[model samples]
Target: MKIFSNPNISKVMKIYEKSKKHTSEGVKETDYSKDKLELSNNAKELQIALKAYKNLPEIREEKVKEIKDRIQQGSYNVAGKEIAEKILQGVQIDKKI
Candidate 1:
């Protein structure tokens, strides 16, 4: 094995040593405290909205009772055009998905 005395190798070694010293000197001991979480105004509002939505009834009893009453009284009337439009709207939504 043979080692050559190159000026470039010496220059690189010097730079590496300088950087090593700087790295060691620049580091300091760090003290970490407890982690904290904070929500923004929008996030707080969204949480409140979500809570409210969760609390809401899945089925509206009053509306259902009114519809049932109308149906029993034979007063419930639905237009064919309205039903067809709703069907077409459902088809459009399905196509989009």
Candidate 2:
């Protein structure tokens, strides 16, 4: 009668069905000539952008040096426009939004 009392019998049945399927059909191995990777159409662009962003040493190192210099000077103010732009682009959000 309680919520947890039944303990997801349907889920248990699903697991049992999958086990039977695995026994009948056996398991298939994946081809790893390309790391066996797949991404959703929505996320595929994000993956590419992330890879490109990581390749930007100047963008990364300049910000690092900017922070270090600001720390030594006892003042730090970030120029966040570029980062905000990148994040917006990554998420495919329009600048007008």
Candidate 3:
């Protein structure tokens, strides 16, 4: 069965085709060659900091080796107070969030 053979469907299809033709004729070519982007001061600072961080070593092998050596010699000392302070700081940050 042909749906467009119905009077209502045929009328709607004719209107849709006419609208598409009119819209296509009315569209003008757009030029994007003059586009410009300006970053805020904070964004510029973040870009600079990101670049510096990218240039840094991903892992501090020297520091890691020093800690490993200290641990092997039974001299690696971790202060309980420092650990407690860090935990408390994390909790405070979570609460703020």
- How many clashes show up per model? 0, 0, 0
Q: Model-by-model lDDT, in order?
A: 0.91, 0.78, 0.93
- What is the alpha-carbon lDDT for the whole of candidate 1? 0.91
Give the C-alpha miss distance for residue 25 in model 3, angstroms.
12
Per-residue C-alpha lDDT of model 3 across residues 1-97, encoded as one tens digit per residue: 8997789998999999999988887775544478799999999999999999999999999999999999999999999999999999999999999
What TM-score number comes out for model 3? 0.52
Q: What is the lDDT of residue 72 in candidate 3?
A: 100
Which sequence of candidate numbers ranks them by TM-score, best first? 1, 3, 2
RMSD of 3: 5.7
Instruction: Residues 1-97, candidate 1: write the lDDT tens digits.
Output: 2343777777988999999988887775545689999989999999999999999999999999999999999999999999999999999999999
- Using Cα atoms with residue i matched to residue i, what is each candidate's TM-score against the true structure? 0.53, 0.27, 0.52
Q: lDDT tens digits, residues 1-97, model 2?
A: 6653576976787799999988776545543465577779879889899999888775668788888998999897656998898887977866456
Ranking by lDDT: 3, 1, 2
Ranked by TM-score, the better of candidates 2 and 3 is 3
